[model samples]
Target: MSGHRAYTPSLRDRLTKAVMTAAGYLPGPLLRPVAGAPRRVDGQVLDPHFQAGLRVISLMSEGEYQDLTLERARSVVERSAYTVSGRKIDLAVVTDIVLPLGGADPDRADLPARLYSPVDGDEALPVLVYFHGGGWVLGSIDSHDATCRYIADTGRLKVISVDYRMAPEFLFPTAAEDALAAFRYVRDHAAELGVDPQRIAVGGDSAGGNLAAVVCQQTRDAGEKTPDFQLLFVPATNMSARTRSYELFGDGYFLTRGNMDWYERTYIRSDDDRLDPRASPLLATDFSGLPPAHVATGGFDPLRDEGEAYARRMADAGVKVSLRRHPTLVHPFVNAVGATPLAKAALSEAVGAMRMALAY
Candidate 1:
């Protein structure tokens, strides 16, 4: 006791700040050696950075957050995403618009959308109508802002983020209807949106991905011109949730079987609705005449098998299909770009795919 120094909060705070600042200024090449690359582990190529991030998140969460109700989960996940995603990047031009809900009686008061364009663009460009992934229950344009920005900037195209109606409140077919409506709205007003009508595509992630697929199906059924291309990221293609991937990766993964069960029950009106192509696109008898497709899946995600199945079905139906599976990533990895190097790398690949598909 006689030789010991007294504890000082101010000194400790200064020391912490100095350490963080020093680490922040380290060169990228110096940090790259510590970041490490993806390596094989148990038949999966796991990125060390992602694994470390998952562990930190698991420590911070996975406890004292047992309630999975819609309200509670939404707040927690959104905050988590915002914290993990850091800051939003600045695009050349970003704007918000209200899309008029068309058809018999117009509901212009409902739909809201955001548009993102590359910083280097000034002329008419290709466009993609994008939906946000949240199992038809959770996410929004704000949640998928970074993902949309990545695609828009990387592809040098205008990207429209549609705020579609979600489940329980709107129920089945409503989101799909909104997706198609947004697509049509954009196509009809492509000139005003500074995009070429003939070069427009459709895309989404998870539930959003499902909506994009349903939009193509509905377009074909309605005898309307289909989108030039479609991009789906770990989409839930089937409501049945009976795939082998469900059994293998359903529990420990970020997306669980129980959550899917809840989402289906909340979104579908009845058991019969599960079989409807509008709810489960995988059950559609015909996959013909849809746009060229890009389907991506995370190997550890519960929806992987069904997404891959849908892609295969499209390919067999003569639709040009490209499927990419990230064997070690979990669901929603695309939204984790700021937290994990692996996710950032995967997102780059996805954005590149869109650039090619959109011909930008």
Candidate 2:
């Protein structure tokens, strides 16, 4: 028997890619009317709205963003985000700011961050320190703008989206380092941000979710005030993609194992980096005394098992854990909230948990 190889698209896959590519050159008016229907990939039935979004994505490119240079991939993601996520909003008093990178680097400048507050509130609000996910390689505050807005509006809490430094520019520990620095910055400056320092929570989807989990563990270890709660949406909890979910759902879904491998390889400086507890929170020895956690996973996501596994570990280690697995959905469903009822409902459920946990 042979070991697994990178996925090779079938003839149909090739044709689909070609057709979608051709459609991309059509005028905006011609393309605007197209819609995608619910279709099964392998055995899983993708959500109709999510399927429609995938059509839009298909028109943009073939294969994974992993194949492109960091710059080109980022441009594609940005354009797709704007097309799928709609325009950035002025609601919630959104502002851009710089947060110090902390930790004894005289030359290290502050990180870029964005703050989103609910419209017109006199009292201090609970805040969710958010990180955008792109395998720790491709996302930014702008890429995840719409999702942040949805979270802020639905959860009725302030949201601070952090633009942590990424890989091929800055690797593993840098992103994690920036996350901790941003968390500390917000906690220390809560008064100025009009947020209740004590009520500030941390959350993110996919790669960002991994950072959130790591930030929680780092806080616990440092004897610092822990986040009020954690909102993880399809977080990649472990760098080692050996889990069964990865094997079962790695190829056909939106997130492929090959792309995942590309992400891990790009973000990690050395093979040993995979075992670092900060990079892979599931490898952490202790989970006790961490804040309450709500972990959401997609049944068809390559990263699903690790997220659920981490939740199980948290539960066993006496931490409060809430795990929601959307059996029919794929990764990145949270971003589909604007188009899919299922995605919106799932996000709403997670945010409601945050609201209850934070008591705001």
Candidate 3:
């Protein structure tokens, strides 16, 4: 738990990284004519680097998630995580552990988790209980290892990345219930984990973000202690309906409309389940007492409109919320922190907000 090591990339991974890094440096003028004039939708032009990257991805991709079998889709995500997550950050402590699910179900399997702590920090630090994205049907602690390491090292805080149960196997409410359980366990055991119970934060991207928002609402409605802050990146706030962003950017973006439909079908029981507040936090009755939040959205992402709408809803309900729209980015920017400087900077900004919010 008190050492650091670098992740050795495979030959294919290294080659892929090299190609992407090179593409990032290409002049915009050279890329524009080929990738099509800088796409301007919703008043935001797509980042030239990302446009080039997307072109590369499209050329290299085997198939979209909607077209791949579930197992193949999951494998593709795992490989992509390693390829684009960059090198792992060095931290003072990194350890794998199991979280006991001790709530209503005593017989449930313990969740796999990883804890990351920076070298420079006090004995007790603010902690972010993070969840990985993949429409709740993919991703794992391994997939988000670099992300947690980056947050822990750069933010000078502790991070516990939860490996929640996924879908097509563990249906609706399972992931949501597990997320709540993980947060509760961390809060209740903060002392043992050497984290500040008073400053615990909940965060995640995509489906994971949905869980974080739901956790806040669930705690509020149940009259329990809530997270000190919430960080949501490209969150699917409302799953019941598609928004204008979906209509605009859903086709060519990394997260396509068909992919989202597949995820929903794999994760939920029926159309009615999509309307449940647990599945769609925006449909919740109240957002007034939820913790302060930073909702970051990519202008080109299908989830952009809903994410912004969620932030607005929270603010209107009297919750303090910060909505950051990265005009030139896409859905997976958070995962690409190591692959590109811009993505790294974007994550740094969000982590900076988390640090400031928990500084007290």
lDDT of 1 by residue, 1-360 (tens): 001112222453344334323433444344445445544543776444444445445654643223466665665556555544534678988887778675456432248888999854558888889988887877777777778887787677889998888776777778887888889888888888889888889989899999999999998999988888898999888886588888877775567888788778878889998888888999999998989888888877889889999999999999888899988788878887665555667777876776677676
**lDDT of all the models against the reference?**
0.75, 0.78, 0.85
Kindly list the per-residue Cα lDDT of model 2 for residues 1-360, writing each as its tens digit. 001112333565445444543443444334334644445554677655455556656665644787777677776665555554533445657887777664477535477788888767656889999988888888778778888888888777889999888887787788898888889889988988788878989999999999999999999899989888999999988885479888788876678888889989989999889999888899998889999999999978988889999999999999888999897788887776444557667988999988888876
Estimate candidate 2's alpha-carbon lDDT, on a 0 to 1 scale.
Answer: 0.78
List per-candidate RMSD values in Å: 9.0, 7.9, 3.5
lDDT of candidate 1 at residue 72, scale 0 to 100: 59
Clashing pairs in 2: none
Return the candidate ranking by lDDT, descending: 3, 2, 1
Candidate 3, run of 10 with poorest lDDT: 1-10
- Candidate scoring better on TM-score of 2 and 3: 3
Mark the 10 consecutive residues where model 2 has the least summed lDDT: 1-10
Ranking the candidates on TM-score from highest down gives: 3, 2, 1
Kindly provide the TM-score of model 3 when superposed on the true structure, using C-alpha atoms. Answer: 0.93
List candidate 3 stretches off by more than 4 Å. 1-10, 22-36, 102-107, 120-122
Off by over 4 Å in 2: 1-44, 86-90, 102-104
lDDT of 3: 0.85
- lDDT tens digits by residue: candidate 3, 1-360: 111123445788679877665655566666776477778887888887778777867877989987888777777777677767766578898998888774466435578889999854458988999988999887777778878888888888899998888888788888998899899999999998899989999999999999999999999999999999999989988878899989999899889999899899989998999999999999988789999999999989999989999999999999988889998899968888655667878889999998888874
Candidate 3 residue 167 C-alpha distance from true site, Å: 0.7
The window of 10 residues in a row where model 1 has the poorest summed lDDT is 1-10
